[model samples]
Target: MTPTSALLSTRPWPLLLLLTLLLPGLVQAQQPTAVIAARATLSSWSDPLESLGTLRADESVTLSATVTDIVRELNFRDGDTVEAGRLLVRLADDEAQADLRAAQALRDERRNAVNRLAQLQSRNLAPRADVEDARAQLRQVEAEIQALEARLADYRIQAPFDGRVGFRNVSLGTLVTPGTELVTLDKLDVMKLDFTLPEVVLGQLAEGLSLTATSPAFPNAVFAGEIASIGSRVDPVSRSVTVRAELDNPELRLRPGMLMNVVVQRAPRNALVIPESALIPQGQRQYVLVLDEDDDYRVARREIGIGARRAGEVEVLEGLAEHDLVVAHGTERVRDGQTTRLLGILDDDTSIPELLRRGRDQAEANG
Candidate 1:
């Protein structure tokens, strides 16, 4: 300082200018850098198995007629919800109706004859053989009537179960024969999702396991379901087993033949978790900046072992503890032993950009 002070004294204006320029930097160095941090939390984590699946109605059937007849009346409109035994279509049955009436007339005549013969036999005026013959004739007429009724039933179409009907395939006066497609019916109260998983995970497949599904048609909606059954046999070529899950479709938003993404969660366990942004890859290792609150909030670089990652969260297998705060944002600008000002805490629900914006607003308000 002896020689330097003499020089500085001679040129005090230059020294003052240097101090003026360096003072701001000195102040900035003393101040801590702002960073967004998050605490390592113990949370329930599960390994997810993802696969493509197709959605089908819980119960689906094609409604058809069994006898050739003209559609005399259409009892249901397109897309109508029908109940079991509800008649959806009525075919022309005038001819059958006439035949049934004639059979009924004959049945009544036979019954009267049997009664008359019984009365005469009771009074010893008719032979027992004649009474038996009348009784046999009455039974034969009754059998014929039953057969005609059954044949008449085939001319009408009824819903076998409660379900929604598809578009009208046949209209009034359209003649339909046996096995002719009338309309499609599907039970849509519950949907069935079928997917295949590799045989390796067959052990994890079980009835009643919870799963989630999403379809492109409803981007924001998530469908929850449970495994209903596991296929009895595995596919030999694909080495996969089919799994069927049942989803409640109270709103009727899901339809048959919809492609969906399925995720099956398995092996749930408690683990230390941190935001994925905190991980910094160094060569083959993952590192994070952990804050030492006791040492004036200084940050230290730490190597951590990572396991499964999910939804922007990393499962910490080692080198972290519960409640250990780690630098989540502005990590690139920070160095070892550097103190950091916690702008905000990052959570699963809070994002990094949101925290940074909040931090900036807070800083502006403070200023």
Candidate 2:
């Protein structure tokens, strides 16, 4: 009390009052701030066209019985990989087999008659008409046998191509008729993806161009493929063209009807690239707080022109130069020409874009 009162008593009352008011602001200005940052760099950027697509099997079909019969055997299980011509299902073929046998016996008997008649004709004992009639009977019996054999083939269901079989709808001993679906077969070694894009970009698209695709089923995996075909005409209503690409799926992980996100790179050019998180959009203008060139710890707001974005990076068309530092995080806490101490420079591998994505993933997991 004595020291504080002595100092206060010697100072003017106005001076003491003024000092008390300034102390809080001085302390606030000196407080340390923690934030993440990145440098604007000169790099080549491609306008990556993104679109939603559907994955389809290279070949697919619903295996169905061609004729009405009771199922005798099912040689495949649900989701089994099979080769072309592999026997899939067998129907009760007893009646078909009996018919074939009867046809064969009749043909054999007719052949014997034809031989006897031919011998008689050579000896001039039987008329030539008799030999001709026997020969015609033999030919008719052979035709009946051929028809029965063809009908017999319908009882055995075989795979049309190499593929994976889906769940069976009809089990052994189940009565099935023609056009009844038994199972589904899909060739998954390669997948076809169909997507649509604006007709304006059609001139840039061509066959054999490489593309990448990602699916929600396997978020961490990326599948690479190439453009297999392009649409011949653009849709008048949507003014878009349908594109089809083929992806090699050696692991057979991708299945038909799965939705995928596709990225197609087009028109590469050199530009100033920055983390997409650094752009601060306000009203109709965009801004970035760039570190001051003279004072590395200070930042100043600058309006920027932006172009196409891909991954976690955005193309800076103007108002920024290579090698300029920009505050990527904690922008709301910063002001133009304010002093800021960067926690540390962003790691080359840990860009702000990737970090933001990780943050979003964590939030989703937590929820």
RMSD of each: 3.6, 8.6
Model 2, position 318, has a per-residue lDDT of 95
The list of candidate 2 runs beyond 4 A from truth reads 1-45, 268-367
**TM-score, structure 1 vs. true:** 0.84
Question: Across residues 1-367, which tens digit of lDDT does each residue of candidate 2 receive?
Answer: 6999999787898787998999999996787554578889988767788899998999999878889989999999889999999999999999999989988999999999999999999999999999999999999999999999989999988999999999988878999988999889999999999999999999999898778999889989999998999989899999999999999999999999999999986775688888888999998888999886477578789999999887778889899988888998978888887877665456576755566666567658966
Model 1 stretches with alpha carbons more than 4 Å out: 1-17, 112-136, 292-295, 335-337
Superposition-based RMSD of candidate 1 using all C-alpha atoms, in angstroms: 3.6
**Candidate 2 structure lDDT:** 0.88
Residues 42-74 of candidate 1 have per-residue lDDT tens digits of 998889899999989989999788988899988
What clash count goes with each model? 0, 0
Q: After superposition, how far is residue 231 of candidate 1 from its true place, in Å?
A: 2.0
- List TM-scores for all candidates, in order: 0.84, 0.64
TM-score between candidate 2 and the true structure: 0.64
